[model samples]
Target: MPRQKNAFAHKKNTNENNQNKNSYQKKPEVIQEQPEPFEDLIPRIERLEAKFDEFDSSILEVRKRMEQYAKEREEEKRQEELERVEAEKAEKAAEEAAEEARIAAEKAAEKEANKESQKENEGSKENQAPEKNSKDSNKNKNSNNSAKPFNNSNKNNKNKKRYK
Candidate 1:
């Protein structure tokens, strides 16, 4: 029985080895080692480097354009500030001019009012003088008329006959 067991174990080991050999042997790995010549690879490497250089140059160009755009934007803001300052100056000048005009108009109106007042004073004086003179003349004439009867009595008294 021991010999038979030994023979069965030997047969199992031989079968596993055979399966491993058969499975591993059918497809052999092929190693292809073709050494590329240095001259042929140089142009390919140079083309790849040129492509990388072109990409880098494009990135640099974009950066330059962005910087220029930023500068232009800053300049535009400065121009806007200048314009605002100019507008403020113009507005102030206009306001001052308008104020001066208003003052001139007011002064002219005041002068006219003073002239009118002076004229009114002169006219009132001229009108009042005649009224006062006429009143004085009327009083004198009434006094003269009342005294005429007294004057005639005095004159006729010399012609009367005296009764003792």
Candidate 2:
């Protein structure tokens, strides 16, 4: 029994020590130093790096195209702005022209009304001249003629005798 107990105690202690050893042991990162110098490796590195340079150049070209597209869009916007201004100017000019035409028409209408009023005044003067002359001649003729008596009383006496 004592021998078995010592063996079992030895086994437990060995298992505990193994667990502690496993817990204490950290994994080391591997870093390999190349024998070649940076200068000696440049040509080979350049060969691989040329491929990345080509991809970078393609990306730069895409960026340049995008810039050009943005420039064209800005130019289109500028052209639209200019056109809008021109259209507004033309609209204003057209409205001004219409207003001018209306003013001219009003002036012409006023001139015609004045002419018609003058013609009416002249015509009324001419008509009054003829009527005034005729009235003066009639008044002179009446003053020259003798006063005439009415024969209505003689006609009434004759009509009474005939009825009787």
The TM-score leader among the candidates is 1
lDDT of model 1, residue 98? 98
When summed lDDT is taken over every stretch of 10 residues in candidate 2, the lowest stretch is: 1-10
- Residues 1-164 of candidate 2 have per-residue lDDT tens digits of 45444546657778778878898687776889866668778888898899889999999999999999999999999999999999999999999999999999999999999999999999998887555558878888887895776769989999999999
| Backbone clash count for every predicted candidate, in the order shown | 0, 0
TM-score of each: 0.50, 0.48
Identify the candidate with maximal lDDT: 2
Residue by residue across 1-164, what tens digits does model 1's lDDT show?
A: 45454556657778779988899668777988867768778989999999999999999999999999999999999999999999999999999999999999999999999999999989998887555558778889798886654466654676563421
Candidate 2 stretches greater than 4 Å from native: 1-48, 128-164
Worst 10 residues of 1 by lDDT: 155-164
lDDT of 1 at 86: 100
